[model samples]
Target: MAAERVEKRGEEEAQTRLPDLSFVHDKLQKFQSKMVSDFEQRLSCMVEDVLQDLRQRELRAHEFPNFEKSDRKSTWHNRVTNQAPADVSDAPNGHANGTQPRPPLQSETSVRKQRRQLPEKVFVARESYLTALLQVEHMRTIYHIFYIILVMFLLNVICYDYFVDGRFDLGLGTFRGGLRRLHWVLGVWLLEHVFVLALYFAFRGWALVRHRLKPHSSLQRFWSHSCLILYISSQLVFCFVSTSLCLKFNLPFVSACVLLLESTRLLMKMHAFVRYNAERVLNGKAKKEDAQEEKEASGRPFVPPLSCYTYFLFAPTLIYRDSYPRTSHIRWKFALNRLLEVVAIAFLYAFIHERHIHEHFGQYGLEPMGPSQLILKLFGMMLPCAVIFLCGFYLILHSWLNFTSELLRFGDRMFYKDWWTSHTYDGYYRNWNVVVHDWLYEYVYKDMYTHVFRGSKVGASLAVFMISAVVHEQVLGFALQMFFPVMFFLFGVVGVALVFLMRSAPKVMGNIFLWFSLILGNATLISLYAMEHYALKNCSLSNRSWTDRLLPAVWRCYN
Candidate 1:
């Protein structure tokens, strides 16, 4: 009886624990299998990433732009500028100085003889008077320039209508009434050079004084004065000449303004892109000692600045005018390269997290990440959105990183703004979304300074804002899949007005207003997010119901 009871107890215990053992066994098998799949997926993704890098490399190397064959008369290495005097022996370069004497005009027969006598002239590293200003170096300066332009443009336009004209149409017969008076008021002595001059002396003088308490070089003085001039001039052109032309031509004021703004913005970006090679690449590729110094100082392995360098890889092929080789453009090649990178990174992440997710699930194709794992994915989506939004906000916040990280650090933090609006404000936007900032500076502000307003800060500011608003709206629309960046700008312009007006007020009053603005700003942001999220969710669902349903099918196919 005792033995039977013991046996029965043992049997019961075994039965109770049997499922646990079986469960463990099944769990181990699932984990092993899933791990394998995840591992494979990771391998696949990595392979894809490498393939992408390789493809871009090959494309940029081969596709090079389709410039006319005649243009090939000047290879990058050869091609001498006509800087040299006419009767000189070939100084080392075999071309006399910077200028090469013009060969006599000839039909094809004489051309060959001249070619034999005078080889191509190359511009070597003549003394490194200045290193190429890489996009990274130029980004912040560019961004601030853009923001200044945007703000000035917005302010003038706002003041013209909301405050000056007050009303638009003249219904009754008063020749001097509504629209005409409004247009006059908007166009009138809205700008005078006196206050602008005061601003220039105060800011520029102070900057120079602080830098060295006395001007060291004519170049420094010239740079400061010109910078100030640019601000004033850009404002005048954007506010007066450009605006008047729009009215005279019956151009859509806002649309015309936006066009001016966007072109400059793009140009600014291209400038930064060009400068990157000037600053970082040329120096980086020079020698071993430089590479060691760059790594030690920057603490970034791989390239001198990995993120910024990536921009060149893509930008040289797609964005810049004369970069890369002609044979590189394969159809749909860029798209394929992007897809491959996505696969590699996705697979790598999934494989790493396999144990954390379902033990049995391996490479659940397109499986939505659970709460914990999802933050990274959400981060990627939100980052770009925030960047586009902040370009408008940069007009409002007036910082670099919230604006210009694309240039300084390159693509690494190209989509970040966390550093921009922290308490000090300096640390924030300065390096955050550098790419767009570069665009604004070179195309809008610098052009205005050197060519447009002749370095009038206020004018540059106005130009940048108009350009920034238009570009932001377009980029945001593409990113968020909606329209109304225009509305966003209206709100942003209002925000700018509030900020500047507050800055001008008495300290106590300004502080109060600033705090009030800050709180309102937070609430507005929350509201915008909720609105955008609701809109996106509804739209995505409406458009892709079948895909939502077929998720399981996708999983099966991938698995």
Candidate 2:
């Protein structure tokens, strides 16, 4: 009985031992597979290194022609053969020892090279000069000074108005007047959005249609070009019609100008989108000829997703991309601060208009004017004009745009560069509005260089300046409801001349000159325009002939 129990216990032990044995076997199989994978990876790395060395050797051979070809071949052969260890060489079906040839390394190397050459489409940290500047104590102090000055100006205006008129008006009446014209503004704004959406969809749909058609067919090409031309024509017609209606109805010209500017901005963005995608599509088609190419190599279809396009429409950027670097969370405090700044700036602007601008130019054009009075007026307006210019810059380019960018989590905050420190007019122009500058650089200047001028940088630059000047003049003309070429001549001619003149000046002197020129320019623009505006308002234009009306009231209103 005892012997039987012992044998039964041994059999039970054996049965338990079977699971342990199986587990050990499974672990060994996994370990063996891992080892094989690790070995293969190491071997692949060695092969790449060997290939790179061979390439280096080939390059050296070219540099030193005295190196014999036979010596080079021998060196290459020895290096390749010795790259593998004896253990690897002895393995069954191993590639070493000349039994099996190594796989072609060209494709893998090419892929790696292509990846290395790919452009980064996002901003790096600390890329925005303004954002960085705002962090510095000195710059922050300067900003605070400006804010205090603006507030003080606002208070002075309010007190002066109260003392003179015996009323507690804060210029809300002007605001109310603008509010009454809000419908016109809203209508135009909505129309612009609708037009942009329509254009986006039309472009996307056309691209899809082209895809379905035979590749490179004349019908497809003709239709695509025709649609593009028609779209451009429609945009031009919209601008003219909007301007004409504003003039005819005597609508709020400022609101009309805003609408026109917004429309132009959207049109430019749409053009960029179409142009960028067209190139992408062409490259994709070229890559698609090779069946073995990766899908990414063939590139994305020309039609961007609607969600992306919509986001881009509101994004504080002119360059369109499917995706951008996004912040993890919205900084509500920062956004609110910027918005509050905008409000303060708006109030300051209103105060300036009521006090300085309306007080001086409220009556008429350079009437009863002597040389002394004209000079005094120009000098007096300089500081106010500079403040206005600064406020305008901060409100639009920095605060408002930054607020939008933060809300949207747009990572790139470089809407403008260090334009304040610009030593040349060209530099200032390039840095003043980076968003617009980038668009001009990429689309207008580059296109001119590539297509129209055939690499004439001067021609491309001149073309860009002309286009910018014309657009600026159009905005100014529409806003003021006057046919003024002051902005055009200043920006296109004087600005261009200064760019070359200041190009070689000492940095400190150039910056001083830049500020001086800017202050003088702003003062001149504001004074002259204000005079003309009030002249037209106060003077009897009904008695004037067509030629007289066409001429600036500033020039002949005194007569």
Candidate 3:
């Protein structure tokens, strides 16, 4: 009885020492709840203060437009302009570079319209998709696989030459042959650049002449008309001269390709420069009363620096702006890598043509084949042609453009998008070459819709398609020295039809169809063009006339 009583007393003492456990737990919970409530109250106050500050800033943005110089350049999505602000020190009558005065912001609708008409381009600091993707291990592996395939192709060429002739050879004869007359290509390109540069000074001189003359004076009017005539005549003459030189010089196919492509780029750049500045020149004439005010507002004359014009000529863009987002410094290593890829891809093209394209089609005109054999040839060419197409994309759009952009310290590097994943033709066309598509959209499609087609979207879209088709055909025709409308038919007719048909297709089905069409179309292009090229060489025409030159040589080969 004594021992049990002692144990009971010990337990009672321990419980007293522990204090009230439940009371302590309740107190802690109350403390946590109070802390949370206090935090919530403080956070709410902070958020409210931030909101008030934002509201004030927005109000100021509206009340004092001068505060928007920097913001205005960046506020719009994918749209930016290099025009001076309204309060700039040297704008002719408070206008930017003598640009037409902004209309009164009388209504919301008009404001929206004005916004739509703003320049539709923005340059932001960005790396290309492939450059970013290649940083990841898995994506880098895919790129490595392409290099491996190219190496395998080279080995195959070596083995073939060794087995046939009992001597090792690189089998690059066809490639070397095609790249002949490179010096001529370079010469023509240099000459074209000289002409393009001349245009800038010519326009600047005319602007100065106009700037000095009295506004609305008869002499100014005559000079303005003369300037218009000069622009038109110069452009036409440049086009004629460049094209005739390409044709008359009897340049090699590759030389012609370079000249033709460069010519198109120069023409587009020239037009963009003129079209943009012409508005500014005309605005000065229209707003003569505001000229003094603009001069007072701006610190200097409104002419763009020659450096800006020269930069645009080599920059990986077609749009003309006085300023663009730029990097702090050029990445020489990055530029070197891109240039190396260009060289490698050029070799890849030559190998593909020699092995798969030229070998099969070289004897096309000399030999006869049945329909089944022809179909087999067509199918066989599909994979090779698809590879060539992808290489070509990388060569011109990615590698070449990126090299130039890096060298120039251009910030916007989005020369293409994820076109391979596109499920619709419309998406593919838009994403394929963003640089060109942007030019077409801003200058061609929008202008047609607003001014020419009068709000007819269909007409504008059609115009865009037609222009693209014709230009594509022209390039190929000049390169091959033959007239073939296969590209035109595929691009303008079947491509458009597929776009509408696949507009709402299921994602899986649409993507499959898109790839199928691309492969098949590339196959068709390579086969037909190759056959025609060989046909012209191997087959003799009884009468070599201008019309005969336009006729399909492949048909004559069979006849």
Candidate 4:
């Protein structure tokens, strides 16, 4: 019996070591059956391992920042989403998705205190409308007409120079002079980029340090608030220091404009980064303490990669995200055409300035003018200003933005909507410059409504207008080295009033009214700014004082 049991165990071991091919008649068939069995077992194990890895990755992807509630798919393209419908548009109030509803008021007098989540900005592959439209024959004619106008302006310049000066001249001296100190502008921009890069690393380090601290402890809260104070102080210092340097070095108008504009851009980028991540950093403990919250926060990044932060600093949109929709390949031809358009439009501006603006207002403050002359000047400036308005729209919003987007291979092409079709100021404001509008709406308007004003819609709207007005005024005022608040009054007061008044206007009337207002407003703006610019140069200061800089000197010039 012992011998039989030992023999049985030895036979079991031998059978486990190798599969039997007893039915095969040839050596090749025996080898093939053995190989097939071994391959089947290995394949099954590999598939199981792959499926387990995929499950882990899926869990990581579901984790969202504290600010976002649901991860909806982009309206423009198909990437993975939370099974949201593709047909719906992004509505501000969150009604389109039917997921979030407006909260009820707390009491008869009190408003809702709960914060509303903003709709995520979607990115998809698309071409700018004008870029596509110009490809058609009818739309191409308008482009040709503009080209012809450019040629006519060039001819007029050459003819006038030949006749008056007895030599051909392009008269680009002013244009060239205005663009001086370009190298200084470039240097400043380089430094600004470097500073922002350092700022990102600083933020990343703080996040890591904070992550290790006891969640919701006094030390954690202290560091969080201290970081906030430091960030605000540093940004203010940077702004003031850069502007002061511009004044101290006496940078030209164009250089000052570039530097200041860039300073504002970086400031916005930094704020967006900080504000978007505020919840995650502050609520780190919630993930660990609560089981439900832990499921959502598990595998989510504590701090986003440096690469993502760096990309946000330069991306066309002010709003930041981990990733954006991207194109499969770059359209080199389209990029080249956009580049050419930018150059052509720049020359068009110079020509318009020389023939229309400079001829009428170049010597503005040097001579006395009657009220009739002033009215005539404003009207005459209207057509040229309209041209300028169109040129600027195409140059920056379409050409320049498209160029950068193409280079980045960014898929979102809806930078600006069909703002021209809008009948009301509200629609116009939202459609025109969709890039900047998104940032303001998300960070400024939404935050105020959710946290500060307690869902007071009117108060939130007013706050948005105030913030925009101030920023606009700051850019224009600082660049021009004056304290005139014409932009502030126009944007905050007059523009807001128009938005309300035009609400009831008829479609046909509204369209006409919108155009009329735009032309008139732009004309007044250009005329006043130009007059003041030349006035400061030509008019003598009685006593050099702050009042002289703050007050309009056009009156002095006329006196």
Global lDDT scores for all candidate models: 0.40, 0.73, 0.78, 0.75
Q: By the TM-score metric, which is better: model 2 or model 3?
A: 3
Clashing pairs in model 4? none
Instruction: List, residue by residue over 1-559, the lDDT tens digit for candidate 3.
Output: 9999999999998898667876788899999999999899888867876886698579646643333444432322244442332221222121222123555545887666655563556555556667765765667888998899789888877787788767764645655576677787788789888888889898888887887888799999999899899889988887777667767877767777888888999999988887777777667533223878666734223556688888888889997777666677777998999999998887777777778987789888788867887898999898889989898898898899999988877777778877897889989998899889989987899889889988787899899999999989888887887788999999999988887888877556788999998999999988998988888888877656788776788887776
Kindly indicate the candidate among 1 and 4 with the higher lDDT: 4
Lowest summed lDDT window (length 10), candidate 3: 86-95
Give the per-residue lDDT digits (tens) of candidate 1, residues 284-367: 333245876766645221222333334443331112222222221222443343344333333322222222122222323334
Off by over 4 Å in 1: 1-271, 274-311, 314-439, 490-492, 505-519, 532-559
- Candidate 3: where are CA atoms >4 Å away? 1-106, 111-119, 166-171, 214-222, 285-301, 544-547
For 66-185, candidate 4 gives per-residue lDDT tens digits of 112234223322222222212333332222322333345456333321223334454555556676556556668999998897788788878877897788657566557767787887
Error of 2 at 49 (Å): 44
Q: Which has the higher TM-score value, candidate number 1 or candidate number 2?
A: 2
For residue 84, give model 4's deviation from the true position in Å. 11
RMSD of each: 26.3, 27.8, 17.7, 25.9
Clashes of each: 78, 0, 14, 0
- Candidate 3: how many backbone clashes? 14
